[model samples]
Target chain A: TQLLEQSPQFLSIQEGENLTVYCNSSSVFSSLQWYRQEPGEGPVLLVTVVTGGEVKKLKRLTFQFGDARKDSSLHITAAQTGDTGLYLCAQTFYGGSQGNLIFGKGTKLSVKP
Target chain B: EAGVAQSPRYKIIEKRQSVAFWCNPISGHATLYWYQQILGQGPKLLIQFQNNGVVDDSQLPKDRFSAERLKGVDSTLKIQPAKLEDSAVYLCASRQWTSGGPGGNEQFFGPGTRLTVL
Candidate 1:
């Protein structure tokens, strides 16, 4: 089974602090996506990186795809209380002509005021 | 445009009970997905449908879990004889399919249905 391992399972940081979450895997993916989910709600797409070594910025968040396409990272600068949530990384796995996403366990981040 | 919609925000039932959840994707979205998200974990895809056709259901537990997307727009997921491990959030998502298969599309998610199996 292809698994995405996420680092720092739980994070509690003060507001304005910077934090980074990592997702690593042995298998390569065609594309990687990052999502943030609040309690009682489903995940919302933050950004998607398709090419190796690609980087995308959305406001205060910066997402980077690994050069080998086997890993990805999400960095938050000056995080606010609103940024506290569960962050997940997912990628499409082509298993026998079937394309479905395999997701990481996720990192739970808490940005305290 | 409206986001995906799901009914019964929360449900609590004993083990071995049966339950079903409904979902309505955003209008015109040709691709729909059902996922199960256990606490402290990311959402896992249980099934995927492309305009009323099954695309993938490799991870779904066929014995107790079943889902269908009829008419290519709305869908339902049912869990019969639920186990304690079945307690989790059931999320429904949909995406607009373009000429290029399943890549490069942003999926919109609905507020999940939280099920608690005792």
Candidate 2:
């Protein structure tokens, strides 16, 4: 019964602005994955954080996993119009052999040019 | 390499009608997955197959929904007497089994089939 709660369900920001979206859970996870899904397309993986307090950057985007493994965050330093999409966080709990993912509701972002 | 492929990019049906969608996984991939993504929500795993064998389908609504992976390659999912809440984008994904387990592998996704139940 692990659940992922994401904050700021919808965000509208101007181009070049910065923002951070959060994913929190009450249960500890073995790993966390970030994905970006555009309209009419399936989600594409952005990054995976396996270590506590680990941070990974993909260009202008930065992803961090909480030290307790109960939370994660995605920060965009300077978002562009192309970065507008729904951001999702998925968790892989320990002892899950099939690697099934339980995803958060997601944060929809719109970047105005 | 080619990615996963799904057919009928869009389908519109009235409630109580039947519909089916097809998916072809990436060549040599041993794992395939089907997911349902409601609007404003993340994708939910509907079923998972490991080389044509069902691995997990706990969340699938078996009463009116069915899926099959044939020959460990192509797959199909169907809904009979669909409900209005069934409207969502169905996505197909595939992954090659590796030593680190399925969780460590990356999944390649298809464009998804948008189902609209009116």
Candidate 3:
């Protein structure tokens, strides 16, 4: 199984605090994606980093993929209440032909306003 | 320009009862996926379809669960004689398509159907 392990299952911080979440796995992946999901809604894509040692930014959020393509990280600078939600990382596994994504148990973040 | 859509935003049923959920992917999307999400857990893929054809169902519980994407647009997922463990949110997502065979394709998800079994 291509399992992705996420760190800091739950985080609570005051407004304007910076935070970083990590996702790691033993197996290599072809691509990695980060998603943010709110209550009662489905996940929305934040970014996808396909290359090793790649970085993508979405406004105040920054995402990075490991050099081995086996890990990724999400960082939020000056996180506001609007930035609170579940952060998920999914990786596309490469096998024979088509690939499938395996998601990790998300990091639940709560930013106190 | 619409996102994925799902019906029965919430359903409460007793154990052993049967229920079905419907999903309509974004118009013109060829790939559709069904996923199950339990509390405090990430969504797990139950089945995947590409234009009315089954692409992957390795994680689906075949004995009591089934799904289909007929005509390559809307789809249905059914659970017969459901177990309490089956309670969760069922999410539908559509894969993005482009000229490069969907590289960097990000899935668009629906609000999801929340099923509660008593």
Candidate 4:
């Protein structure tokens, strides 16, 4: 079984504080995706990282994929209340017959103003 | 374009009761997915349909949980004799299948139906 372990299951921080969440796996993955889900809603895709040691940024959010393809991280700079949500990391199967996604338990973040 | 739509935003029932949820995928999306999310956990895939055909349903509890996507547009999931563990949010998602297959495409999600089994 391919398992994705996420650290700091819950986080609460004041506005303007920065935080970083991690997703680690024992198995290597071809592609990994980050998603954020708010209360009463399903998760929404934030980004997908496929290359080793790759870094991508979206506004104040930054995503990094480990060189070994066994870990990924999400960093939020100057967090705001709007940034509060459950952050999930998922391994996406590419070019496979099923091509399904396996997700981590997720990290719940709360940014208080 | 409209996103995936799910009905019955919330439902509460006693254990052993039966319930059904509906979903309408976005237009032109060939793949539809059903997921169950427990509290403090990420969503887990229950079933996958590719244009009205079942692509995968390995994790589904076939004895009590059943789902169908008729006409390749709308879908329904039914659970019989629900247990307390069945309490969770049911989410519907849709994705457009491209030549590259399921890779790289974003799966749009619905607001989800919260089910409570008392």
Candidate 5:
């Protein structure tokens, strides 16, 4: 079984501040995905990084895959209250045509206005 | 496109009782997944189905939990003799596997059914 660990389980920030969350694992995954979840709702897909050292941008949010494909990061610039939610990083592995997802503990971000 | 749908957004049951949750994945999606999310933790894969065939259920507590995807569309999860630890949000997701380009493996999630065992 593969496991992903995320740092700073809970974070509280002021508006316009910047923060970064990290996901690390000893086992390499074929791909990694980032998600943002709000209270009383399921998570929404933010991005997926497949290649090592790959970088993807979604507005102020920037995601980076580690050079070893065993870790990933999420950086948010000029954070706003709307950005307050749980950020989850999950590693997906497929044995064949079937896929199984492994999720980290998740980092809960609270941006105070 | 409509997202995955789950019924009974909330459920409250007593310990040692029985409860069931329903899920309807997005149309044309061949894969469906059920996850269990405990408080302050990420969701854990409970079961996975590929067109009504079981894929991986290693993490599922089969002792009392059982899930099935009938007709390769809708699915249901049932728990008998529930325990206090059974209280958690159940999430349903669907995805279609693509040959390449990240494999289109992203799982789209439903609103989730929150279960409370008192």
Candidate 6:
């Protein structure tokens, strides 16, 4: 079974602080996706990084896939309180056809105003 | 376009009781998925359906849990004789089947049904 390891399981920071979370795995993936989830709601897709060394930005959020496809990272710039939520990284293995995602434990972010 | 829909946003039942949750996938989406998410954890895939046929159900606890996607449009998940450990949020997601893609399909998620077994 493939497992994703997420770093800094929990984070608390004041508004305007910048932070980064990471997801790593020994197995290579065909693609990686990032999601943000708030309390009482299901996770929403943020972005999907398919190519190695790819970077996509959604306003204040920046996501990157590693060159080797074994790791990914999410960076938030000047975060606001609205950014407070759970961040998760999911991977589609090299040969998975059903599109079933293997997810990391996730990083819980708390931004204080 | 409407996103995925789920019924009974919250359900509280006693241990050993049975409970069910419903989900309506987005129109034109051929694939559907059910996931169980414990607090402070990522969602775990319980089952996947391609139309009315099940594609994968490897992670589901078959002894107590059962799910069906009838007509390939709507689905229901049931747990009989629920246990305290069964308490968690059940999320339903759907995605359109594209011929090919570099990344894979993007899934649209529903609000999820929170289940608590006392």
Error of 3 at A33 (Å): 0.3
- The digit string of per-residue lDDT tens for model 6 on A1-113 reads 68999988999999999999999999887788999999988889999998989999999999999999899999999999999999999986434445888789899999999
User: In candidate 4, what are the lDDT values of residues A1-113, reduced to their tens digit?
Assistant: 59999988999999999999999999898789999999999899999898899999999999999999999999999999999999999888755325567889999999999
TM-score of chain A of 1: 0.94
Stretches of model 2 off by over 4 angstroms after superposition: A93-97, B98-103
The digit string of per-residue lDDT tens for model 2 on A1-108 reads: 689999889999999999999999998877889999999888899998888899999999999999998999999988899999999999863353366788899999
Chain A of candidate 3 gets a TM-score of 0.94
The per-residue C-alpha lDDT of model 5 at residue B20 equals 95
The deviation in Å at residue B7 for candidate 6 is 1.2
Candidate 4 segments whose C-alpha is farther than 4 A from its true place: A95-97, B98-103
Query: Per-residue alpha-carbon lDDT of model 4 for B1-118, expressed as tens digits?
Result: 7888999999999999999999998999999999999998888999999998998898999999999998999999999999999999999999887335323688889999999999
Residue pairs clashing, model 6: none
Model 1 per-residue lDDT tens digits across residues B40-79: 8888999999999988898899999999987999999999
Highest-DockQ candidate: 6
Worst 10 residues of 4 chain A by lDDT: A92-101
Write down the lDDT of every candidate, Cα atoms only.
0.89, 0.90, 0.89, 0.91, 0.91, 0.90
* Stretches of model 6 off by over 4 angstroms after superposition: A94-97, B98-101
Off by over 4 Å in 1: A94-99, B98-103
Report residue B16 deviation for candidate 3 (angstroms).
0.2
Clashes of each: 0, 0, 0, 0, 0, 0
Candidate 5 structure quality by residue, lDDT tens digits, B1-118: 8999999899999999999999999999888999999999999999989898888888889999999997999999999989999999999999875334444567889999999999
Candidate 2 local accuracy as lDDT? 0.90
Tens digits of lDDT, candidate 3, B70-99:
798999999998999999999999985422
For residues A6-107, what per-residue lDDT tens digits would candidate 3 score against the true structure? Answer: 988999999999999999999886788889999999999888788899998999999999999889999999999999899999876544324456789999
> Per-candidate DockQ versus the true complex?
0.57, 0.58, 0.56, 0.60, 0.60, 0.65
